[model samples]
Target: MFTPRTPRIVAARRLQRRRDRDQTGRFLAEGPQAVREALAADAVLELFATPAAIERYPDLAAQAPELSPVTDDALAALAETVQPQGLVAICEQNDVSIGEALAKEPRLVAVVAEIRDPGNAGTVLRTADAAGAGAVIFAGDAVDPYNGKCVRSSAGSLFHVDVVRSPLSVVDLLQDNGLQVLATSGTGEDDVDSLLDGGHLAPRTAWLFGSEAHGLPADLLSSADRRVRVPIYGGAESLNLAAAAAVCLYASARAQR
Candidate 1:
């Protein structure tokens, strides 16, 4: 069993940092679900599991191209969670270029711009996949999609959807691809339901979502084809980023399908 101080274990632990992940072109995916998804995507480079985890998930171990039996202490050293799930896979960073993603002629897409919270970003990614979005673009200063919290929060959807990390102008890219760009804002001129009712959501669409603290920038909002708001019938002031994204993406999904 590999110990915490083992050379390979030490190297794997470094992946917890963004700099290391970027430099190595790899990231860590923890828990059985994430490991299974990474394996299915052919993104896993190496897998580390505790003896008990291997026994409990023999099928996962059997499928690994490379597996390392790690001591519980070593797993703890490598994991970011309070209770490590006993399995972690070192996987390749699979983000594609914005042009490449748009080349597929996706009907529905989500553009995450400067969203710093990993949980919110991950939830949006998972929601996009559930709503049948063809791609998700992490633009501007958005959080790393490979963040452990983001990966865990995505619940395996990260592997299922096309991911794009680009600093290019997303509005222009989507517009160039014949996708109508819609930005969500409290003071927006159009309502989501109104667009759906008018059959405007049937076309290829890309929903632009901004940071949790601040909504989309003025330039992006202006660049969007339409600024839309999700009508809230309740006393709630506003919906969080992930909730708002779900409402908007599903509206488009319903209209397009």
Candidate 2:
């Protein structure tokens, strides 16, 4: 059994940092679900699991490119959660270029910009995938999708949707690809329901979302073809980032289909 002090386990523990992940062009995926999805995507390079985990998830072990039996302490060292799931996989980063993603001509896309929270970012990615969005772009200074929390929160959706991480003119690019860019905002000219009723949401659309605190940058908001706000029926101030994203993406999904 590999101990925490083992050379391979020590190296794997370093993946907890963004710098290390970036340098190595790989990230860690924890839990059986993540490991399974990573395996399905052919992204896992190696899997480290406790004996119990190997026995519990025999299919995952059989599918892994390489499997290493690890002590519980070793698994803990590589896991971000307090309770390690006994399975972790070192997988390659799967982000593609913005141009490459747009080439698919996705009818619905989510462009997340300057989102700092990994959990929210991941949840949005998962929501986008669930809404049948073809791609998700992490633009500007958004949190890394490969962050441990982000990967975990994605719940395996990270391997389903086309992910793009790039510093580019996102609005212009989407417009060039025949996708109308829509920005989500608290105070906006168009109401989401009105747009849907008017048959405006059925076209190829890319939703631009920013951080909850700062919202979208001024230039991006202005560049978007339409600024849309979700109606709140209750007394709540506003929906959180993930909730708002779900509302917007699902609206587009409903209209497109």
Q: Cα deviation of 36 in candidate 2 (Å)? A: 0.5
The C-alpha TM-scores of every prediction are 0.98, 0.98
Q: Model 1 over residues 24-75: C-alpha lDDT tens digits?
A: 9999999899999999999999999999999999999999999999999999
Residue 242 deviation, candidate 2, in Å?
A: 1.1
Separate clash counts for every candidate: 0, 0
lDDT tens per residue, model 2, 8-49: 999988988999998999999999999999999999999999
User: What is the model-wide C-alpha lDDT for candidate 2?
Assistant: 0.93
Model 1 poorest ten-residue lDDT run: 165-174
For candidate 2, what is the total of clashing residue pairs? 0
Off by over 4 Å in 1: none
